[model samples]
Target: MEVLSLIAGGVTTAVQPINLMLIVLGVTVGLFIGAMPGLGSVNGVAILLPVTFLVPPTSAIIFLAAIYYGAMYGGAISSVALGIPGASTAVATTFDGRPLALQGRASLALVTAALASFVGGTVATVFFSLFAPLLAEVALSFGPPEIFALMLLAFATFVGLGGDDIPKTIFSICFGLVLATVGFDTISGEPRLVLFDIQGFLRGIGFIVLAIGVYGIGEMLWTIEQTRGDVTTTNPKMTVKGLISDSKEAVRRGWKGTWIGSVLGFFVGVLPAAGATPGSLMAYGVAKMTSRTPEEYGKGSPDGVAAPEAANNSASTGSMLPMLTLGIPGSPTTAILLGGMVMWGLTPGPRLFIDESEFVWGLIGSFYISNVAAVVINLAFIPLFVWMLRMPFTILAPLIFVLSIIGGFAASRSMHDLWLIVIFGISAFFMRKFDYPLAPAVLAIVLGPIAEPTLRQSLLLSSGDPTIFFTRPIAAPIMVIALILIFLPALKLLRRKRQVTQD
Candidate 1:
């Protein structure tokens, strides 16, 4: 009943003209950005975040959140029409999507993707609305020690489960933690990492600057380096009649895959630092495993495209759980959202529901509106989006650079931040070259500050006894989980090495 009332109040708030317009605009822009190769939800949200500075907090969040969902829908376009995935989350879609396109069934593939995305997003949003408040209520019992333990768990999970290269992930996270310590100490007024005679260093690096540089500018640079010539897409002639017919076929054939993706994606997304990429990949694997025609998975199977599309979209919604409730971001895109919330002077956590009910509920309400809007907009504007794909990278690359520079400068109106963007962008390019994950670094930057303060407070509360983290009943279990996550990978590596030696 309480959840229903909040949902009702949210609906009432979201229907306002200004908010509704923002939602449409956000989805449109997000679709365009997401359709462009190398630009996904992270880049879409980061680049546009500065533009939202002039709007009200609730409206800004609603707009950004809309873009996030819209991009998930748009990513399927490139994956199906071309072999290239528009977003990392959509990579799994290409296995079957491109094959279907090659087989002249692009319309069926696209329709399936769109419909599955809508189902996944809507179901996940409903789950978010129902579960977030309960999670937040439970989180209210967490003190500083528990919060610290949770942050450790987040870092551990990402490092352990992110990729096969644990060392690179650890290095990325440690680098971010070091970056987090560069500015003034929150407990004390002392500046820590300020270089001599550099005024901007005192203000520290803005999250927006880092986000735009690493995701937007860095991505553009990589795209420029890799892309050789004008890319053309398979333009399948899609009519309204064909679309309606294909939609029915997709639902009939892909319903099981959709359900599998949605359930797995939502649960994985709820885990801190576990983003959409794994969820989508896992869903695709599950679909293939269960399919009677498993041999068709990589050869234009509709179920192949449906599963990943459904999972990625659902996971996108799921990633919002920790960000909204515990103030921990599950993905880089959510990290940007968390940063935006902070910039708007809104503190995320259990208290957010009580203190800013309107903002929280309003944002939640906008999710439903945006999910439906994304499908309609994507279907209606497919031609235009395909045209957008034909735009030269030479022209698009410079435009991205300009926007990234503008966003960096807009953060604090500082030239220093622009320079920082350039530095970070270059660093990110090199990191990408070495196969180091940027998400962990970004996550660490967001969580590092929070972890430091929480740890300090816990120590103070326990009268300098560090065992406080393990003494509390709730904190103890969480810490144990964290420790297990941290060591499991190392243990695996050790056993592998020992087996090789024996062999």
Candidate 2:
């Protein structure tokens, strides 16, 4: 009851004209930035963090929080419209979002993403308000071994992202893992796989580079080759009735995934370093894994679109809990927010709730408001986004090319990355032609950096005994489940072979 009273008071604080105005402004700015390739919530929050200084600290965090919330929603827009994930968090969204777009169901995909995001954000905020302190302790429980086990679980779930070709999926994941190891050794800090002694390899391959190359350029190439310049998506109608129907269909089809992602994403996001990207990916994998119609997952399934969209937004909210209560940032954006809090003469930790109750509650209250604001603003812009889809293939191909090149360069400002993007793009086109799933590769590169360090740290903690993963109370179950998931596809494949032989 006391917490409810605080939340009510916090809501009142967030409703003040200044805060509400900032909420809308921040969400709008974030929406567009997140829609841009190579830019995500980190870029949006960092770019505008300077502006927050002019306001009071409470208002500043709310503004940045609004942008963070909006960006989560915005990230799905590019995934659906351009076939490129607007943020790493949205990579799973592309698994179905892009397919929906190609099928002229972009409207349905966008609507599902928006609704799922709202639901997920609302659910995570409720969790945040109810169990902030307890969850922070749970986050603290994750040591290197536990974290590595969790990463193992993530890789196991990753198989769900690929086609039924088990060996091909394994190959794709291995390829990605190798690419993930191209940079310096996580502990030794020495270059390990610098091909041709290129100094740029030290920087390693950015996920955005691979994502843009594979989804953006490679998709473009595949489209041109397939259609031979005769591609056209149905011009989506954006009337009020159309939106209502899409909303209903989204709920009918995607509700299960929305709930799954909201719960799972929040849980994952509550971990100290596990952020929205993995949360979204894992959510997508689970949704597909659990579906009776698993084969429908990558082919414009509304549930598939909903899972990742919901998870990313929920995880973004859940990430704030550790930052507010434990002085640990659950995500990259929250890390910046933590820094901003310190700059404003406030400390995050056990005392934060008692000493800075108003600030903490105000931010949480703003989460409720910003979710409403983002969905409403995003819905209003649906027509504009869909309009882009109507463009002829000739015009759209060049646009994709320019955005891919610009996004790669802007993220790192490296000519080497630029060249790699081009090379990867062409390579992706070939991979596509061969029917190898690129999703596993993308997931690997994203998780590899995090996985490598934790695995190495876990091994060191156990004196190089691999049994550490199976001995720790928390790690053991996760490792067991991960191992099962890794073998599940192969088991199914072998069973099918046996049946065929008997026939």
Candidate 3:
């Protein structure tokens, strides 16, 4: 009942004139951004984060959350129309969405995606409202040792479940941690790792600088390379009666997968480093594996399209759970949001619910508003987005390039950051080319500062006894689990090798 009242208050706050306006505007911008191939919520948020400085922190977060919600809905548009995923999280959507388009059911696939997304997001938000406060209460008891153990668990998830090259992922994380140590020593108050004695290094490498470089400029470059070949799109036409029939058909065929994804996605997404992409893929696999007609999945089935589309949106909302309650990011996009919160002079974790009660609840409230706005706007504007896809990437690339530069400059007002953006962009291109996962690196940089302090504090409290991490009641099981997850891949590899030897 107490939680419900706070949520009601949040909804009241979100419906204020300026807040509502920003929600609609943010959703509109995000819809277009997500419909473009290679541009996802992460890119849209990173490139536009500096612009949020114009608004109050509460409204700024609302706007960004709306963009995130809208992006999840829009990614399916490209999958249905162009036979290509608008973002990596939507890749599963393409399996059935493209087939549906090829069979002239593109409008149906898209409508199903929109409807499933709505259901998934609303369900996840209800779960969030119910569970977040309880989690926050548990987190309030945490001290340095417990917090450090949680941080270890967070990185461990990347090693166990990141679905990337293990060596390269470790390397990326180490590189980001090294960067996080550059500016100064927090405890000692001394200059540290100032490369080449460059004055700019004293300020540290900002996460925003790296994020914009990787997602904004580097991703744009990668897309240009990928799209060198001509893309043939399916022409989808929708009418009022057609939409009505498609909606009914979508509900009848996709209801099961929608429920499955809404539940499954939220749990997966709450695990740090296991964001929407894996959640969607997992949902698709589960939905097909359990289906009566499994063979129908890859052949224009509405269930197939609905499962992934719903899971991705559900996971996007789910990713916010840890970020709000525990100060850990559950996804790459949330990592960036975490940094933005710190930049705004706000701390995450349980105390944030106390220190910034209005800000916290208001952002939570905007989730409902954003989800509803995203579905309505998405359904109404499908034809418009499909038409916009006809616009050339050759033209879009230059605009993103300019925006990335401007955003990079806007954050620090530094020529130094601009050069760093170019360097990181080129570096990110090579990293992606070599199949290195960048999310772990981004996450490491964001968590490194917080993790380092807690580790040092824990060590001091224990008189240099590393066993303190395992001795605490709350930290012990978490530490044990983290160690197991970290070594899981290596254990699997060794078992495989021994089996091969016996064979």
Residue-wise lDDT of candidate 2 within 1-503, one digit each (tens)? 99999999889889999999999999999999899999888998898888889999999999999999989999999999998997789999988998888888889999999999999999999999999898888889889888778777887786644565777778888888889999788788888899899999999888888888898888889888998977766555778899899999999999989999999999999988888888998898889888889899888999999999899999999889888888899878899999999999999999999999999999989999999999999998887888888998788879888988898889989999989988888999998898888877887888888888998888888899999999989999988988888887778779999999999
Which 10-residue window in model 1 sums to the lowest lDDT?
A: 227-236
**Candidate number with the higher TM-score (2 or 3):** 2
TM-scores of all models?
Answer: 0.62, 0.97, 0.62
TM-score of 2: 0.97
Order of models, best TM-score first: 2, 3, 1
Which model scores highest in lDDT?
A: 2
Model 1 score (lDDT):
0.78
Candidate 1 per-residue lDDT, tens place, 1-503, comes to 98999998887777789888998989988887776555678888998999889899999999999999888988888666544466667767876886776566777788889889999998898988998866544535667887688678767765554443888889988887777877799999898888665888888765556666676666456655765534333444556776788889899988888988898788667766556766786677667767888778768888988898999899999888789888989788999999999999999987898999999999989988888888898778755544443456566456556656764565458888888888898988888888887656665665677678889999999999999999899989979987887787888889999999999
lDDT of 2 at 336: 91
Sorting all predicted structures by lDDT, with the top scorer first, yields 2, 3, 1
Clash pairs (backbone) in predicted model 3 = none
Task: Report each candidate's C-alpha RMSD, comma-separated, in the order given.
Answer: 7.7, 1.4, 7.7
- The whole-model C-alpha lDDT of candidate 2 against the native structure comes to 0.89
Off by over 4 Å in 2: 497-503
Candidate 3, RMSD to the unseen true structure: 7.7
**Runs with alpha carbons beyond 4 Å of true place in candidate 1:** 135-237, 383-503
Q: Rate the local accuracy (lDDT) of all candidates.
A: 0.78, 0.89, 0.79
User: Best by TM-score, which number?
Assistant: 2
Query: Candidate 2, clashing residue pairs?
Result: none
Q: After superposition, how far is residue 368 of candidate 2 from its true place, in Å?
A: 0.2
